[model samples]
Target: MTEDTAAGNTEAPANPQVKMRVLGQFIRDMSFENVMAQKGIAGDVQPEISVQVNLDAKKRPVEHQFEVSIKLKLTSKAKGMEDVLFLCEIDYCGLFHVEGVPEDQLHPFLLIECPRMLFPFLRRIVSDITRDGGFPPVNLDSIDFVALYRNELMRRQAEQANKTEA
Candidate 1:
């Protein structure tokens, strides 16, 4: 083997390393409706809410680097209301580096670690948005990345199976 290859094989390869560099952060988009929440607070109104979370990651040309983002949407409405009381969306991201690691290890880091790192920031934003809207702070529960990843994998598998069957 060539010296360079030999060196790489001998010592851990200088894996491409990625470090999240927060370029810029802003409220990409946000909306809050306190009027609905206020109306629902009393017995006259009953409140119902639905929340959806989505995770996505992309690799940058920067070697061993990736951008992982989480998007959340929350909708709150009254029992029989056609109107929404609260509708909010949050998009948060973080950069990560992966070097000297196998693909198996890197996969989890991108899917799990990157999101975990971004969660606190995303959570804070959600809390602030609700608080500013005159409602109690909405604190999101910690997520289990492993479980989330597994579910995603299963969902994709099922979808692929359906496609093949069809």
Candidate 2:
């Protein structure tokens, strides 16, 4: 109020530009089961696909380094009979070096931005796994990380509200 008001300047100081780097990435675990191969299929079949995504982040012992993991679970089944065609699950992780993010913004940054960076690799793995398992290759649609984060936040808030009411 003293110097700034006198100078006719009211804007706050600008935040530093965010800095990010992907140190490395890898698949921590993967399992693909081809049920159709084992049981054999005999009919005109329609496929239904379902996919689930979960994200986790942890700070590493090394400074400025963190680990973020994306868990992808996908399943395909025959439309009406509900016979499972195949199941593919993967846990992919990335090591990142990040700086200049505010403490309050870190959680969403890790969950959203980090996963976005790793999504293409995970998508390719899913496509490859399905193609190799003798099914029509699954090309996953792009995920909405911003919506995912907002939905998660709303869910947690509702959960907390329910607990308090109880």
Candidate 3:
């Protein structure tokens, strides 16, 4: 028997080691609009708000590194009025070192896990920006990363299936 095999270290040495880390976090873009400011609007009426969140990840050419970013868009319309109370959009990003994750599991890890780590910061930024824009802080609810990942996978699969059938 080979000495290495006898020692039971059968795995290949070059197999990427599994590790995850956050290297940095920063706001890549930010925009805030207070449409009603010109009208000298006051806080007499509560506004209806809508928010959208999107996540994207890209692998760096360097080994075991990735950039994960979350894009948040929020719009508040003055209730019972035609004016837009405020609009805020932010693209927040984080640098991550992820290694050893298997190819099959890597996509989910990047989309789900990496964002999971960066969410609180992104959420805080949204709230602060909204508050600074002269409206009540819009507190974002917790996101469902697993659901988002699964939905994205399903969408891709459906798209592929359509392409194949057509």
Query: Which of the predicted structures, 1 or 3, would earn the higher TM-score when compared with the native?
Result: 3
Model 2, C-alpha of 135: deviation from truth (Å): 0.9
Alpha-carbon lDDT, every model: 0.75, 0.92, 0.89
Candidate 2: pairs in clash: none
Each candidate: RMSD to true structure?
5.1, 2.7, 3.3
Q: Write the per-residue lDDT of candidate 1 for residues 1-166, one digit (tens) a residue.
A: 8897877756765766654445434445566667675556554555577888888888889887777878788887777876666777777777666565567777777788778777888888898998888666788888888899889999999999999999
Q: What ranking emerges by lDDT with the best candidate at the front?
A: 2, 3, 1
Winning candidate number (TM-score): 2
lDDT of 2 by residue, 63-123 (tens): 8789999999998999977789889999999999999999999999999999999999999
lDDT of 2: 0.92
List the candidate numbers ranked by TM-score, top first: 2, 3, 1
Cα shift from native, residue 55, model 2 (Å): 0.7
Q: How many angstroms is residue 2 displaced in model 2 relative to the true structure, after the best TM-score fit?
A: 16
Name the better of 2 and 3 by lDDT: 2
